[model samples]
Target: MEEGICYLTLNRPQRLNAMDPSLLEGLLEGLQGAAAEGARVVAIEGVGRAFSAGADLVEFYRA
Candidate 1:
């Protein structure tokens, strides 16, 4: 927490931080946790070149 802000970093730089089910779940949980912890602001960042490549189509197509 920095200056009442919470930062959530997407860790999968190898895949350009693709949004798989696990990642989505973790994001949701992280947001909830941040809110519960009384964070005034939330910041989402990604590692590597892209912030996100959006949803993982491989996982989507598999469903």
Candidate 2:
């Protein structure tokens, strides 16, 4: 968080930032934190080749 801007980074580069339960939870937490801190903007980004590869099929199957 900086200058009222909250940055939520998806750091699962190995899996192309797949949306797993943990990651989703983290994002939700980040959003809540940003709101609590009065952030005017929330910027979500990824840390690797792609922003997101969608859901994690392997993890989904394991569930």
Candidate 3:
């Protein structure tokens, strides 16, 4: 933890941090890691302007 805070950042700025299966899985993994590391607080942040546009519609369309 940095300065007593655990930060989880979304790295897909090009896609407005859209939620994909991999990203979602990574988030869960990060959260689990934070807990395992005894982090008191976990903060989720986005790299770019938008936090997220929501789930990626392209994946839905493909299926």
For model 2, how does the per-residue alpha-carbon lDDT over 16-58 read when each residue is reduced to its tens digit? 9999989989999999999999999999999989999999999
Query: What local lDDT does model 2 show for residue 21?
Result: 88
Worst 10 residues of 1 by lDDT: 54-63
Backbone clash pairs for candidate 1 read none
Clashing pairs in 3: none
Candidate 1 lDDT by residue in tens digits, 1-63: 878899999998888999999999999999999999899999999999999999989988897
For model 1, state the Cα shift of residue 56 in Å: 0.7
Give the TM-score of each candidate. 0.91, 0.92, 0.86
Tens-digit lDDT track of model 3 for 1-63: 886578999999999999988889999999999988888899999989999889988976776
Our model 2 lands, by Cα RMSD against the true structure, at: 0.9
* Backbone clash tally (model 1): 0
User: Which is better, 1 or 3, measured by lDDT?
Assistant: 1
Deviating ranges (above 4 Å) for candidate 3: none
